[model samples]
Target: MATTLLLAGLMLAQSAPAITVEAQPGLDQVGYQALSAGRPDLAIERISADPVMSASDPAALINLGTAYARTGDRTAALARYKAALTSRDRYDLELADGRWLDSRAAARLAILMLERGKALALR
Candidate 1:
């Protein structure tokens, strides 16, 4: 009985499951389409449901910020944009410097910021 109990304890310990974290879905082409189709609220809802969108993905954060901005939610837009800037990856800087980042995306962000009256001087 003692041996069986010991073996059972060992087996239980060995069988411990590994924890796995799921990724957010984040905004995709489909989401962008929805947003462009005058469905900002729906786009926001769908994008927000992405499991992988942590506070890190600038693209996702930017999209979310844009969605909020479209809805006239300046507070949420600013917060999301600030978060995106904070999480701005090497790619973002590269893009800003007009190096490796997508020209369209970089230009778009710059134009958007300027239009929004953000302090572009600091960037």
Candidate 2:
């Protein structure tokens, strides 16, 4: 019985998703500071370094895209935002139709699209 319980516990633990430290607030602050300080490059780098802000994170991807756009990297910015959208779709985790896996994803995508000179036509 003890061995069965231990094995079950171990299996449960192994199945849990890894926790990632998000840099949302800090990245937001850094973004504003960099923008105000006329340093979009720094903002881009700071936000892009976050593990949670990679292509998989819609919110992070949007922020990264915005940063790229601010730095005049329109192509890269678009790519990131599109990648975010694609990721959101592939997960099929309830983000379809812009519901968003995380609440921030949709909002960030909207903002980033606007920044990227694309008008959001949310249905």
Q: Per-residue lDDT of 36-93 in model 2, one digit per residue for the tens? A: 3445477567666666646465544554565566556677767766766766433212
lDDT of 1 at 84: 58
Highest lDDT, which number? 2
Q: How many residue pairs clash in each candidate?
A: 8, 0
> Each model's TM-score, in the order given?
0.52, 0.47
Root-mean-square deviation of Cα positions for candidate 1 versus the true structure, in angstroms:
19.9
Q: Mind giving the per-residue lDDT tens digits that candidate 1 earns over 1-123?
A: 010000000011111211111122232421344444445577578667864653555555555665565666767766766665666442322322234433224324533663554311101
Q: What is the C-alpha RMSD of each candidate to the true structure, in Å?
A: 19.9, 15.1
lDDT by candidate, in order shown? 0.41, 0.42
Candidate closest to the true structure, highest TM-score: 1
Off by over 4 Å in 2: 1-38, 88-123
